[model samples]
Target: MAKLLFGSLAWFSFPSFADNKPLNSPVDYLSVLLSLVVVIALVFMLGYIMRRFNVTQQGGGQMKVVGSMALGTRERILVIQVGEEQHMLGVTAQNINHLAKLDSPLEVAQPSGDNFKDKLTQLMQGQKGKTHD
Candidate 1:
């Protein structure tokens, strides 16, 4: 009886040892790394193609920001023109509130690229920020 039990236990132990042998090889690890790189590259390529083609960008004519003011670091007020009508909006980090409907639209700044760069530099140098009337 003791011999039979010992034989059965030895048989089970051999199978468990075989199972513990590392199933993963260097080739399997390399294959997984290559697959991850391929997926990341495909995502970046798709993003570039979308930007280059300007996919899903609507032509601007329906609405535009007339003007804006910074009340605080995280708060702002903007006048937005929607078609023929204009609206005043109070903006915060969490929500936007309609403040009023303006009787007259605010004068919007139409700065050229170079002019805007210069203005930004001047503002950064601690000059009094120009207010658009």
Candidate 2:
């Protein structure tokens, strides 16, 4: 009787005791792949929305990023134009600090103010021009 009770409990605990087949279903794989694609698409959509509306940038009426340079992964220097005045600011993940107010606003070749992207575009254009020349 004890052995019967133990075997019954074991059968309930161990699924393999009732069914020897493994859980290798095609539907399961398809479901996982669909879920992954949906999640990736959602991330991209959110990013586009944020950039499109400037959702992360508050009080963007007068302030414009004239220039920006990354000091580290999360720290950077930004030159922002407020009306006729341009102010240089030090920005980090934590807070923003006023560095100085520029008498003359720096010339920006690209209005986006991402220095790396602007520089890359310049380098690519230079190389393309050289190839053509």
Model 2 ranges off by over 4 Å: 1-26, 41-60, 108-133
Highest lDDT against the true fold, candidate = 2
lDDT of 1: 0.74
lDDT of candidate 2 over 4-112, digit per residue (tens): 9867766344343346456477765675577679879999999998766546533548777877788998889999888889899999999999999997678755556
Clashes of each: 0, 0
lDDT of each: 0.74, 0.75
Highest-TM-score candidate: 2
Error of 2 at 6 (Å): 47
Task: Estimate the lDDT of model 2.
Answer: 0.75
